[model samples]
Target: MQNQKTIITVTGYKGGVGKSTTAVHLGTFFGSRFRTLLVDADPNRTAVSWSKRGSLPFQVADERQAFKLINEAELVIIDTPARPDSDDLKELAKGCDLLILPTKPDIVSLEPMLEMVKDLGDANYRTLLTVVPPYPSKEGETLQKELSEGGIPVFKTMVRRTVGFERAAMAGVSVRDVDNRFKSAWDDYVSLGNEILELLNK
Candidate 1:
């Protein structure tokens, strides 16, 4: 089979929605099957720092020279900053296979995320719910229902609110890299990786 380059940008209009976590783990998971590169496009450089801390297997680089570096890997996952400008957003979205938008299942996060979808105009994108309560939350259920009813594509696998995610981040490792204490959260990310791959294969 011929080598194919796949670019996935993980972004959201608002901050604190688990964009970095998703990018880090997704890149790591993709690395298991393909040569993968994780780009820290956020001015914060969170992904670069996390890789340094976790000693991730995949290569992590600053957003500079993205196209040149993309030639080095089959999959490229970008961790973007919050509230990027229109021109920058368009440039980032250009030619990307998937624009993965992470959002919390609440009005506070949902409103801005929806606004971002509008701002980005038409593009290949999917909304992944993050920081969801483990218990049945009316807001979460309602938001999922609303998005589905509106014909918006949402991930069937949601990332739950877990202290393990924070702990794993502090240790500079993906949830799966952490000990069994973080197994549940790690499992969720693995499931997410499978779902994303399935979607991309379609």
Candidate 2:
């Protein structure tokens, strides 16, 4: 099969929505299968830091050099900065094969995500509900319904809130390394990865 380059951008309009986490894990997952390049566009450089500490097998570049990195790899994953309303985001989105908006299952997180979706201007994107509580409360269901009604594609699989995630973050490891208590979260990430690949194929 001919190698087709796929560029996936993870963005959020708010901070602490797990944008870097998703970018890193997805890059690692896809890298296991393909030649992947991860671009850390956030000024914070959280993804680059984590990759360095974790010794992840991926290339990292600043926002200015990310486009060149994207051109050189078969798969490019861009991790945008939190609350970014800049022209750089627009330029990155323009080249994306899929745009993933990772949001926590709460109003504070959902609101800005909606705004970012609006700013995206009808691009093909999906909402990934992260940091979801184990047994979703009524509010969680309500938020999910609202997003669906707003014409956003929300994934059925959710990433549950867990200390393991934090631990993995501190250790610069993916949730795949988390213990049995977070098996579901790991599976959800795997499912998300599959969904992403399917979307790219389409």
Candidate 3:
């Protein structure tokens, strides 16, 4: 496809922050418009397992295949191992067009993400808030404001926690493609995908 090549690396200090899931859905978003590859660089192989369960719209490759497949796709999303050391994060920041650090709103996720941000040191990155509890709770907004005020780059879109993601995972499909009940969850990612595109264009 004519889509500009963009390598996006998704990583965080903790698992279960939806890092792989974000990579998968972003792959889906870009793949639908341009050729895309999702690389399972995580030892847990969450993306591999998820793709194996059912057909994903895009290609899923183990880290070993990344070098070969990366050139063949217009968009590449790498799901990295959790807790990459400062050196690795620095190198990773220099390599990818965008380094996405997914963080949940809870303290458990917040602390490590904060530490990871500190280690990044001027990396071309943005913090993506994930697994946000549904309304009536302002945790996501609160944290986003805090981080932004602190001069950290944070995405405007937040991925809300939903069982639809679990359902989509079981079926190995993009959240929006899986069911209508989880439209909001999918919408969140759609917004994120758009924001990413806009950011890249800038």
Candidate 4:
């Protein structure tokens, strides 16, 4: 393994915003090219359960095993729990190379994400819009504008809402493992993954 390890933390202020989903797929993306590990840092152990149930291509471990694996893999993606306290945020920010805040377009997710960043202070982080409408909608565009105007760093690619994710979850597989019916959804994550890789290279 290389001495340079990249720690990517996928976290959010609220739950069900696709944090685990992002962590899983992003780990898959990186695992394709580099040695990658996904850590179930969330007490819910969603990633660990998903990996056990699904045919994930990468390694998944509980939070307890994260430290040892981080040193071994080229990239480590962490699926964090919702609404971590200030101290936890500080700790995460201190340790991670990149912080990914996955959120939906609605206010239920938006408002808390804004507040959550305040706790992070100056973390190297960016917001990823998830569960967006597939078709063009004013809400998604407006939310992007608002986040931009508020000086929030956001990803250009948005993960649209699709039943494919639900199907993949039920089958214990990733969107990539699902059939062609979920191509669009899978492509969305691919685009997002590419964008993240670009950022990492920079």
* Residue pairs in clash, model 1: 54-172
Tens-digit lDDT track for model 1 on 129-191? 999988766666677889989878788888888888787778888888878877888788889
Pitting candidate 1 against candidate 3, the one with the higher lDDT is 3
lDDT value, residue 16 of candidate 4: 87
As for model 4, its CA RMSD to the true structure in angstroms is 1.6
lDDT of 4 by residue, 1-202 (tens): 2568888998888888999989988987778878899989789988888877868888899878877776778888888888888788889888889999999999899899888888876678999999998775767777888888988988888888988888887777888888998898889888988898788773
Best by TM-score: 3
User: What order do you get sorting by TM-score, best first?
Assistant: 3, 4, 1, 2
Instruction: Name the regions of candidate 1 deviating beyond 4 angstroms.
Output: 65-68
TM-score of model 4 (CA atoms): 0.94
Candidate 4 displacement at residue 136 in angstroms: 3.6
TM-score of 1: 0.92
Runs with alpha carbons beyond 4 Å of true place in candidate 3:
1-4
Per-residue lDDT, model 4, residue 37, is 92
Top candidate by lDDT: 3
On a 0 to 100 scale, what is the lDDT of residue 69 in model 2? 66
Query: In model 3, what lDDT does residue 17 have?
Result: 96
Worst 10 contiguous positions by lDDT, candidate 1: 135-144
What Cα-based lDDT does every candidate model obtain?
Answer: 0.83, 0.77, 0.90, 0.85
**Candidate with more favorable, higher TM-score: 2 or 3:** 3
Pitting candidate 1 against candidate 3, the one with the higher TM-score is 3
TM-score of 2: 0.87
What is every candidate's alpha-carbon RMSD to the true fold? Answer: 1.9, 2.4, 1.3, 1.6
Off by over 4 Å in 4: 1-3
